[model samples]
Target chain A: MTALASLTNHQVRLAQRLVGAPTRDNWSFTTEPVQEPAEGGVLVKTLALSLDPAMRGWMNEGKSYIPPVGIGEVMRAGGIGRVVASKNPAFAVGDTVSGGLGVQEYLLIPQDQINRNGLFRIDLRAGSLTQWLNVLGMPGMTGYFGLMDVGQPKPGETVVISGAAGAVGQTVGQIARIKGCRVVGIAGGQAKCDWVVKELGFDACIDYKAGDVKAGLKEHCPKGVDVYFDNVGGEILDAVLARLARGARIIICGAISQYNNTTPVQGPKNYLSLLVNRARMEGIVVFDYADRYPVAVAEMAGYLKDGRMKSREDVVAGGVAAFPEALAKLFTGENFGKLVLQVASE
Target chain B: MTALASLTNHQVRLAQRLVGAPTRDNWSFTTEPVQEPAEGGVLVKTLALSLDPAMRGWMNEGKSYIPPVGIGEVMRAGGIGRVVASKNPAFAVGDTVSGGLGVQEYLLIPQDQINRNGLFRIDLRAGSLTQWLNVLGMPGMTGYFGLMDVGQPKPGETVVISGAAGAVGQTVGQIARIKGCRVVGIAGGQAKCDWVVKELGFDACIDYKAGDVKAGLKEHCPKGVDVYFDNVGGEILDAVLARLARGARIIICGAISQYNNTTPVQGPKNYLSLLVNRARMEGIVVFDYADRYPVAVAEMAGYLKDGRMKSREDVVAGGVAAFPEALAKLFTGENFGKLVLQVASE
Candidate 1:
């Protein structure tokens, strides 16, 4: 073990429950003396943390896939880290790992907490630390199973994805293209849309911020949408619902647009089109596919190596305190791709 | 035909388009000389007409599964009629047939129109004319296929349905019960709810008009809803959405609640529950299952014969002129079972 240093652990705690879009006041910066790992325990120093739209949902007080982060608790997050010290046989000093380390500088996971918190080793030679938090991480696994298992895209079918420049959407578009499908993406602005089409290789990208998404779909998807991977649900969902072809499959991955609304989320008014078109819309959560992660990761890793799949991580330079403001960038469409906050160098 | 009876054909025609619900003024009554069957044609006298909630959708001028009923044309209707004369080999005199006969005293269907109009012979020995328009007709077919094919209810699961007392709902409730599932229903009034539970053998029925459907679902479906067959969409659909169990299936059969709405239809605000529950919501139109109608009809008919399924028809006593007023009964919930108009007695 390295010599003991005079270091204090910093964490961003939830100060108040959010009513709408989160502000700086919602977080409380706190510091405490770093504690040594007890017997059968591991101490991990977070290198990079993932900021996701689902984090907004975790702030609300309600029943969800996972429990809400309680007041005065460290905010929950998924990140890449390196084990600084370990008293457990499963991990050794300097081993790169990934887990829900929260928005904190150090995580001291006891033996009893390891199973529940999930700590797994990763080979840094295969991908960078940021890549594990992005493509080989939760969002990539989400896009993989959601598009394949739920959307069930086939060759020559037209697949349209909302939130096209976001983490899951970019991965979904590229995967659909690799499977030989016509892909269209709906993103916020021209720059994001251009990046999706030019770099991500999506066949067409609709700039939803510019004008009517319905018209853009009409122009781009002349045959109508066959598979729709919905990440941002709202009017865009309704617009896509209106243009669905017969037997279309809709995969509900997330709903970023409805996350910040103080009012109730708007449902798709044109949902009746599902009846007219004999279509189906189903919801998916990545955690449900945990058992098959190995298969997905192996397939996606092969694609990454061949340059068939590209991952862009918008890594912001900051520690734990920047979490709240960095999270807000997702809602504003400021982040170009997978949003990540660098807590420390690898 | 048989001395060419001295009769003037009485008909109800569309006077104007409906803004909300159809009223008396939306129809125009007229009489004309009944024409004889031309070459390769059939002449039939309308006996009883099926008054359905779908009539409201047909009155609107827009794209749908079928073309809208045009102004100055006889209002479209489905009915069982006796063939008075025929120049086509497919039909014979005195043969009882079912098809889109429209609201009229007489129908002069040309041979070229026979295939498009879908005129088929019905065996009176199997069921009554009212039963042909009720249990053995479109609504029965709608319920059978919608619940079995779309809902795919498994044994030991809990199933919930809206429009419990109406044509489709009643059949759906009974079929789900026969499938060995715990069935719950939602109806407009206390009487309808009581009848659904008592006569239809549903486990419970929620009176949506009396109180909150959400509370009723929470109380009745403690294990949560596994299959929800939605007939009356709107708030009821949203309420059912909230109580869905993991892997729930929501079958969109009809939206009778939103049929008369001049404003936009209220979408299910809690549709995100589909995500949390990993559920699916799909739409079904009965016409799409036309090829398999005989299989569904035979099974449903057997259930009816064995006293496992019951048929109820709320037949109004009047001729073609009563069409407008009889149609409004569906929207107002005045018709307890299958609403039908008696043009002439069988």
Candidate 2:
């Protein structure tokens, strides 16, 4: 219980807004003395932080699904943590939890702001600390609701997912398969593609870095794509739009490819395909499904246990300072799966 | 009864595929001797033809909702006509009809290919022949189904329409107002704007040629747009996307703004707003509602008669020889409303 003067919480703060791909220069590493929780408050030690493609969005200055991280502020993030001290009756010391822990070693959630910070006890019995930050976290919730709600895939329908090796894509592809869909994934590089197909059991995976996604879709989804879970926007989205079957549904989860663009984001030139095919494109933000997170967690936990689903995370060490370099991996397509920064041990 | 001997048919054919905006050089005029209908067939003489923005897409060279107009082929079109000869028990000579008449003086529907041409008898009692080509025709069908089926507008909800003075836009806006929604329109000029707001009963109309559409939307649709029936896409689509309410639905009917573009069609840069708002964008094709056209037509025809809806048409004279110049008026925004070409006087 080092939520006191004895503890120094190291943190990464946004130093400047991004122009394109984020660099270490965009962040400032600092350390601050930790303080004990106030009455009705709880303090948690960050175990791991989720490094996501969406983090790239939070670094920019503009209106988005969530407010951008202000300069000189702690970079916002979500992670698994262990309660080190608690004055709240609801949260006992040593309770494992998941919430917005930021890119820091400790999270001091004030009493009035507990719910706002999304502080909640997470059961490690269903998943490990890192897995809690992966398949059972924000990314998982996004994939679950975005697919099942918007996509509404029918059995025997061909479901295509881009960024197949990434956090959200892995969850979406696996779940679409569980729902009786024929799953095809698109990822950069042959290794990621091979893993998504051979390991994750995707029916096919297109190596976008090596081949034309349009031709790959035509070959893999001969009957045309019934559901498309888009992560990478730009050309990949256009490719899927071209292959959409009549009544197809496209879920707009993230646009990792266009996040770093110095120029305006390339809008899907083939969006007219939506009209031609009588298809739909919809966007989803995971927070809207917060009320039912536990339900999704319960369903996914069963799949994880039965080996019907797999949660793969690429854990990066060096704690909070590693965040800037780690997040850059998302845009470069370097990380193989769910990228998590390990801040502390249980 | 001039189906055989003393009659000649003047026709307009596609001389070349279009690269951008169409010109007279892309069209070739020809004349041929009229031929009688075969067994179980019908022959119709074109009266008034519906000029549409979608015609631009039909002239392109590639896969689309329909096959592209082939080089040297009679240009595809839909128009109101008078049946001159009928061997089918279902049709009679002198019967008023509507179907795919092409850009020609006669539509000769053969046996077993009647339905493929979408040929059907029209009641002059419900509407005039020119009105049939405007509000009761393909554009009307597109607007009705695209707005009601895809937009799903509710009472008091704000519904915005682009290309407000055009064929589909007028139908959508008038119908939206009649259905108890607050209607905002976007058109190119002052006269069209004034007509759309005052004559068509739209709550407001933005003269895009005169002012900023984005600012107009903000002021007019203060509550945000719940349903948007988009005819002119590109930047206008982006403007509406930026002003979308949470859970908004956008009906993608046409992209007249980008139809003649030589460059890649602009994808809405503000499309990410869909994610922020949890909105959906979908496409609609009137042909998909062929079976339901009668239902929509009957309802709209009531609106037309009861004074709840009005159909405005910008009619052009010159028979079939004037199609090239007439259609160009659409892209130039010179046509104030539903543009129609008079192929033959009643």
Error of 1 at B249 (Å): 1.0
Alpha-carbon RMSD to native, per candidate: 1.6, 1.5
lDDT of 1 at A132: 84
Best by lDDT: 2
CAPRI-style quality class for the chain A–B interface of candidate 2 = high
Docking class of 1: high
lDDT of 2 at B8: 86
lDDT of 1 by residue, A1-346 (tens): 5453566789999999978899999999998767778999999999999999999989989898789999999999999999998999999999999999999999999999998897899877666788788778999999999999999999999999999988899889999999999999999999999999988899999999899999999999999999999999999999999899889999998889999998999998888888878899999999989889878888888888999888898998878878878999998888989999999995
lDDT of 2 by residue, A260-310 (tens): 898988889899999999999999999999999999999999899998899
Q: Which ten residues in a row have the lowest lDDT in candidate 1 chain B?
A: B1-10
Model number 2 iRMSD = 0.9
TM-score of each: 0.97, 0.98
In order, what lDDT does every prediction score?
Answer: 0.91, 0.91
Q: How far in Å is the alpha carbon of B263 misplaced in model 1?
A: 1.2
